[model samples]
Target: MKAFRQANHDLNSEPESAASILQSVKEQELQFEQLTRELEAERQSVANQLERCKLGSETAR
Candidate 1:
């Protein structure tokens, strides 16, 4: 009877632990996606600035 009770308790805890881990993974994935978008936007801005500078120099020459 004691062994059965211990097994039942362990089984109950496993689902809760799995849910917590799943939630953490989801949050990290969301954060990673947001950072990726922001980095892309910054990269585009830098590229635009470089192009503008190149065009201005050609006009002066």
Candidate 2:
């Protein structure tokens, strides 16, 4: 029947749809990782600056 054929076609298309969704998820994960690394580096730089400021203040006192 035509309905059965349509159902079969839909079943076959499922894997391609799943693959596209999985690929998108992977790309988003990579972007998240890169953003996390950049944030960590920024935090470290800020911390270093604060420490330098503290040391400078202590020397002035």
Candidate 3:
């Protein structure tokens, strides 16, 4: 990709700045992954609760 090539060129020319940029990108990626996992867990929990409520209502009738 062109983005990767630019990053590579930057890393070659400005090692410290490139390293800082890479670290920031990594931190952002980790945060995004954590948020994604949390959202999935919450979604699964809500789905399970909804199923339980549906089953409970059916049993009452």
Candidate 4:
């Protein structure tokens, strides 16, 4: 396809474009990892709160 050839030509013409794309991908991956950690922390906090609530109800009874 003509579009594929044009894209290939563009990549071949600019080597730094590939490096720039690689850097962008690395940044996105780091951001994804950070978000995953934050989500896990939040989940743990919720679980702790639930366990405390259960303990409180049992003590009240």
Top model number, lDDT: 4
Deviation in Å, model 2, residue 38 alpha carbon: 0.0
All models: lDDT?
Answer: 0.95, 0.95, 0.95, 0.96
Give candidate 4's whole-model lDDT: 0.96
How does candidate 2 score on lDDT? 0.95
Residue by residue across 1-61, what tens digits does model 2's lDDT show? 9999999998887656768999999999999999999999999999999999999999999
User: What does candidate 3's lDDT look like per residue over 3-40, in tens digits?
Assistant: 99999998888566768999999999999999999999
Candidate 3 worst ten-residue window by lDDT: 10-19
What does candidate 3 score on TM? Answer: 0.72
**Residues 6-47, model 1: lDDT tens digits:** 999988876667689999999999999999999999999999
Quick one: how many clashes does candidate 4 have?
Answer: 0
As a whole number from 0 to 100, the lDDT of residue 60 in candidate 4 is 100
- After superposition, the stretches of candidate 4 with alpha carbons farther than 4 Å from their true spots are 1-16
Per-residue lDDT tens digits for candidate 4, residues 1-61, read 9999999999888677768999999999999999999999999999999999999999999
Q: Give the TM-score of candidate 4.
A: 0.73
Clash counts per candidate, in order, are 0, 0, 0, 0
Listed in order, each prediction's TM-score against the native is 0.72, 0.74, 0.72, 0.73
Candidate 3 accuracy as lDDT? 0.95
